[model samples]
Target: MDERLTIASAKANLEKGSLSAEALVGSCLETIKQGDKDVHAFLELSQTAIEEARAIDARRNAGEQLGPLAGIPVAMKDNMLVQGWESTAGALILEGHKGSYNATVTQRLKDAGAILIGRTNMDDAAMGSSTETSHWGPTKNPWDMTKVPGGSSGGSAAAVAAGFVPVSLGSDTGGSIRQPASLCGVVGLKPTYGRVSRYGLIALASSLDQIGPFAHTVEDAALMLQVIEGKDPRDATSVDLTQTTIPELIEKDVRGLKLGLPKEYFLEGMDPAVKKTVLEAVDRLVAAGAQIEEISLPHAEYALAAYYIIQPAEASSNLGRFDGLRYGYHSSGQNLKETYERTRGEGFGREVKRRIMLGSYTLSAGYYDAYYRKALKVRSLIKKDFDDALKIVDAIVTPTSPSVAWGLGEKFNDPLTMYLSDIYTITANLATIPAMSIPCGFVNDLPVGLQIMGKAFDEYTLFRIGATYQSLTDWYLRSPDTFST
Candidate 1:
């Protein structure tokens, strides 16, 4: 079996009897066993995976109708709740916490016959841009062990990149999914704010967090999204998309589509090689008949500042429930107030604490109007910029990140540099729009992602453009040399 088998190829082989669910699962488990020591992608392997595979194999032999992702091994980010599985969200505060209920997304995947392979690592409470902040230690990029696989969804991206799983679910809040996908050389999607349910996902920023998929190809990403995308009563924010189904996006016509190139994204600080490769990709789209026009997103410069304030504010409020009472870590103190203080102080990592404090201060009485309120107003302006631009163009394009994956420890001591990593990706979350990252090219053997943004609920267009662009190039086909056994 090919190590880098995609969801589409795996499904075809499984349906045709050329591949058995058990065999596919075994192969993936073997890949994890062989490579996860270096990548540290998985937090814990699911014991039910083999049992589920055996049942699926039995059903196939008995001629039972299977679901869309039948027998496919899929990884879930630690932030999402999987019943009976420990979900730490890469934070020690929730260490040994077992989920009693499945997140809506987890149930949807299971209903589709996807085998839950394991939970992948993430930044503590999804606060950091690099996986290095994870309490379990960083998830190394498969392409280069010393480099980080972007985060807080880094483990999921690295898992897919390392052939541990063909598809995985990750939550994106301020570029968590897309940034890591770019760094790891995979296809990652952050759906429109209400497109997918957020019921089981641990909240980072309630308004910004969205659960999405990571896959090796655009079609696989589309397929994964198709199964998980629909209204759920459990999530108040989920929209009713029952009447609308995304069309088969593979090789869709993109000839006459207008793609806007955001001038703000291609600024002075980006890696020269990354800028050249992204421009070259745009040229390929132009040669393929898509029209490209330089567009101005005037408020994009303030996106990062607004995002940091809003995200941390929301995170501070949401993470308040884990203060050593009901579940998670506990630190004893003489009084209730002291116990609360001690537990939170000892349980949270440095980045998590920093954000919590920042959020607390911003939301406090004296600073609320000056910081939090101002950020919200700026967020609206940032969103207006995209809304105005999308009216004229079918989609927006840019480099997913300023540079490729850097050495793991390089930016850990410099929090400001780490925050800048989400500079190109945060606007989409603020605007509540759908965005995707696909491999555009490589710089020094590391992958660079081409980010595509679409109007609200217009993921179909992003898929069409991504698939068309992928068809014209083979960058997504390239895998890490060390993990390509």
Candidate 2:
């Protein structure tokens, strides 16, 4: 029942009869019942979670073999399809839409004996950096209720931060997972693009979006990633690459490893406290025997601009299928065109509509060459920057976000500033590399994250660096005051 119990510890206890799956599941559900009202993390709680856990217990008692995450309760983002479960992606247009088939990740979790406890809130259609844009209202930062949890994966991050679940699944298009994890003081991992299948996930930006995990420890996140990562036949983009045993790999020595501190990431305008803490964290890594060198990713400055252009362009295209003629919310009109217009106008939230409009404009006849195509070329340059840099170091290090958690609604009206929140994270997605965020230290009583991005398919290196850093500090173990009891 301990909210701080990690997946490794819980799995050990469960296997030895020291913990029952039912007790663990019940405790998580009870915690959600008692605390979710304030955090607003979950969109819906699964009615059958306890029942499923009990079945796992029965199987364990019968000497049946179990999966890696056996009996663990995991909260999934609303964007992942769970058969017969409402998967709205935090959009009103899909409010009542239930998944007819499970997303590949959802089924993978189930097969691994993970109990999907509920659907967590997110930005409407995964279009925003703050969960405040969610149709169901914002998920409060567990560390400070008045502050925003970074999003659109904020709900999943808050769920773990608030002790509602040991781990949760979230998709990062531009930093949804890492930014929220940094704000919530948890470990979030975005695996190498194509290393994990995207089949069944509600697409935000097909090429940029990736499913990852949020957990209390780097090892826990690695374990979750191991359970869900693989080449799926349903997703053509998924690669058939050899998978590394990340949990075991993280225990390897980090000495002799070279990590890059990108000159572009240490900007003049970032929060001074965050910069101080993150640099201090880098010092700890140096003390742990890792060598550090200053590096440059010159295209980093343009990552944000290119990301906005590319992500929305793809999002607008993917979201086009949600017209009233399909399996979601609809509006009646005299004609098909009017129905399409009204359905989208009345269904999507303000931010979603804004992105769709921006996307439509960029992809239009004249602007396509000027905007979207130019963004694509810039994206290639950004990827080259990372590729050229990674050839020198094992991984790239940077701040996960510019600042710590901000007050809810502070920047809701300023779309430009909101977009800036993801400046540090979008490049990983753009580069198609593996990245992770681990709690470094606190700034103004809120957590800051040190982001480590590795070469494509080199998640093992990122995990190794994260696990090494975590061992050098207790930041990951410190729970928010609200959930520390």
Off by over 4 Å in 1: 1-3, 247-251
C-alpha local distance difference test of each model: 0.92, 0.92
Instruction: For candidate 2, give the lDDT.
Output: 0.92
TM-score of each predicted structure versus truth: 0.98, 0.98
Worst 10 residues of 1 by lDDT: 242-251
Alpha carbon lDDT of residue 117, candidate 2? 98
Candidate 2 has its poorest 10 consecutive residues by lDDT at: 244-253
lDDT string for model 2 (1-485, tens) is 23475788789889889999999999999999999999999999999999999999999999999998899999999999999999899998997899999999999999999999999999999988889989989999999999999998999999999988999999999999999999999999998999889999999999999999999988999888888888899999998878655586676458999999999889766999899999999989888889999999998889989998999899899999999776788998999999999999999999898888899999999999999999999999999999999999999889999999999999999999999999999999999999999999999899999999999999998888999887778888888887886
Each candidate's root-mean-square deviation in Å?
1.3, 1.3
